[model samples]
Target: MLKFFVVTGIGLALLNGWIIWWLWRALEHTGWLRPMLCLVVAVLGVSFPLLYKLGGDSAIEVWLLRAGSFWLGMLFYVFMLVLIMDIWGLASRLWAEPPVAPRWGGALLVMGLPLVIGCASWFNAANPIVREYDLTISTNDPVPQTYAQSPLILGVLADMHLGRIITAPRLVRAMDLLAPYKPDAVLYIGDIIDDHILVDVEGMAAALARVEPRLGHWVVPGNHEYISGSIKDSLDILRHSGMQVLRDQWRILDNAFVLVGRDDMSRHAFEGTPRKSLPEILADIPHAHRNLPIFVMDHQPSMLDEARTAGAVLELSGHTHFGQLWPFHWVVESMYENPMGLLIKNGLHSVVSPGVGTWGPPMRNTSRAEVLIVKVHFTQTAQ
Candidate 1:
């Protein structure tokens, strides 16, 4: 953990230094103006991390966190824009006539573009839309008559990093959007709360318990839960919110299907406690219930093959946030098999949500914040 922080700090310093150097050269301003501009950039670059370390639940802290987070988002765009400008300038010098790029205009383009897009992205992140998917799985064994008659309408809420930035109102709004679907059960695929220190546990709990699904709410801890530095507290608050935390555990729902929740892979790294393997967890199912279709809720989508190999029919996950921001999605996509959206490998159905809340910066450009509604149908295979 210390190593991670040290590496991150170093990276931030170098990146900020590069940005400052570019701004200094590009601005071509005198005295205080250039220095002030660089100072502002450097401060904004480190603000979020610095404020995060000096943890407090005060209003001032919360506002600073928000401002710092927004700046972080803007900073990404600024960095990219500046890099592009540098490349363009180099290419112009090498081949074409050096295009007369105005200093102020260049400055405006770097700052203005991110500002315009960041504001729009903020609005986009705030308002989450409901996306629906229909899935049919074939079962060799006969499904219960009730299950066949009524498809399972599972509502998925993932990555609601409810802390300083994502307050109760955002959670309330997300729940309100899911109300119409009337999910049989709501599955929180982790990162439900960002940090226990900054989170309003009672308020978030109250808002979460507002709508009661027929089968109730089930949750698995994402990396953020462990990252929050109070995993127990986060779990307690989630339980208070009427959510059942399944840490490498399984529950038979209505005696119709198996619901397995795996602890996030980060558990081993963060807590030094490794969760049960998919097959190990599945082995705990009673012989009578073995044939039942297995549905899984894993915070990270890293274990799809394990779930599939363990005979799970459907696996729901969130943690990717679909890269959350633009171009970063490309990076995220490179890491995971199915970074975002749905993927079916052999018989396993995996739905990875982009999530309903922002992690940092509270802005999204590549993907929209979404609540997934999966209507799962069970069809019996021929004898």
Candidate 2:
């Protein structure tokens, strides 16, 4: 962890330094403007990490965090735009008969593009859309007649990151969107709370409790839960919200299916304890219930093979944010096998949500915030 912090700090310092240099050049290297630009760059670069480390639950702190997050989003676009302009300038100098000096138009573009995109991204994040999928889980064994008659509507809410940025109202709005679907069960695939310190636990709980699914609300911790440094408190809040917190636990619902929740993989890193393996957890189920359709929720989508090997019919996950911003999803796609949307691998069905809330910047570009409604149908096949 210390190594990670040191490496991240050094990277941020270099990136911010480069931004300062670029801004100075874009502004024609005005002696009077350099200091002001450097000051702004330094402040915005450090605000998020510094304020987060200090940890306060005040409105000022919240707004400061917000400002810092926006800067981070802006920084990405600014850095990219500056780099592109610099490249263009170098190419022009090499190819053209005469190299032209950088103009005010370029500087304005560098400054304005991020603001415009940022506002659009902010609106995209604020208003979440509902994405629906249809899945059929076939079994040879006789199943509950009720499930066979009707498909189960499962609501997926992932990466809410409820805290200063994702307040109660946002959660309320998300719930309102899911109300129409009337999910039989709502699965929260981790990162539900960004940080306990910055969240209004009671308020979040109240917002969540307002909606009651027929089977109930089930949740598995995401990396952020452990990152929050108040796992117990976060779990308590979820319980208060009428959710069944599943940490390396399983429950047989209506004798129709088995729901398994694995602790976030980060537990080993943060708490020095590893979560139970997928097969190990499944072994605990009595033989009588083994043939029942299995649903697994592992926050990162890192264990799809394990779930598939364990005969799980469906696995739901969130945490990728599908890059949350453009071009970044490219990186996310390379990291996870099923980064976003649906994947049917050999038999195991996986749905990876881009998440319902933003993490740092409260902005989304690659994909809009979404709630997944998967209609799962149970069908019997001949032995």
Candidate 3:
């Protein structure tokens, strides 16, 4: 961990230096503007994380974090653009004179594009979509006659980073979107709250009370739950809000299927609770449920293979936000076999939601915030 942090710190410092260098070049002609911009950049680059971790009570602090998160999100893309421009400029020197210094107009455009994209992303994040999928789990036994007419409809939601950005209205909007599906059960994959500000926990109970998943409602802890440093409080809040919290446990749902929820991959990192291995959890399954379709709820997609190996027919997860931002999702996609959608490998099915809510900047670019209505059908095949 120390080595990881050291490397990360050095990488960020270099990125910041380059960004500052670009800014200086672009605004050099503006006199005092360059120094002032530099100071602002330095302060934000240094203090945003501190402020975000400390959180705040004042409106200024809230907006500061919001703005800081927005800028940070934009910074990566802007840095890439600036690097490209710098490379292009350097290469042109061999063919022609080092294209004269950039004009103010050009600089402004370079800066403005990222902000434009950020604003558009903000709007996109506010409007979430409901993505639906129909899945069939073939088994040795036929789907019970009782549920054949009504295949268990499951509503899967994850990464609802409910904080200042995702307020009551957004929660209401998600509820409204999922209500039409009339899910038999709704599962919250995790990250219910971004942080534990006093205001965050206030209306949570009331807000969650409005969610109506017909059969049952469940949640598994996500990294944010522990990172917020309020695991106990978060659990209490979620329970009060009417969702069953499941951690490394399995619940038999009307004997029709088994719902296995795992702890977030970062549980030990943040909370010191080592997660149970897939084999261990599967070993505890009752003999009666051994042949039943088992659906695993894991907060992160990293544990996909384990769940599949455990003979789980389906696995539901979130935490990727499917790259929530353009190019970023590309990074996320490279990391997982199933980053944002369904993946079928050797008959094991995995569905990863881009997330119904978002994290950082209240923005999404390459992906849309989504609630998934998964219709699970149990079918029997003759050997």
Clash counts for all predictions: 0, 0, 1
Candidate 1, residues 153-251, lDDT tens digits: the string is: 899999999888788788888888988888899999999988776566667767666777888899999999888877888788888877998998999
Clashing pairs in 2: none
Name the top lDDT candidate.
Answer: 1
What is each predicted model's overall lDDT from 0 to 1?
A: 0.87, 0.86, 0.80
Question: Per-residue lDDT of 318-356 in model 2, one digit per residue for the tens?
Answer: 999999998899999899999999999889999999999
- Evaluated at residue 8, the lDDT of candidate 3 is 60
Order the candidates by TM-score, highest first: 2, 1, 3
- Model 2, runs deviating above 4 Å: 28-38, 91-101
Model 3 TM-score (2 dp): 0.91
The better candidate by TM-score, 2 or 3, is 2
Give candidate 2's root-mean-square deviation (CA, Å).
2.0
* Alpha-carbon runs more than 4 Å astray in model 3: 1-10, 31-36, 92-99, 271-273
- Cα displacement (angstroms), candidate 3, residue 99, comes to 5.4
Per-residue lDDT value at 195 in model 3: 73
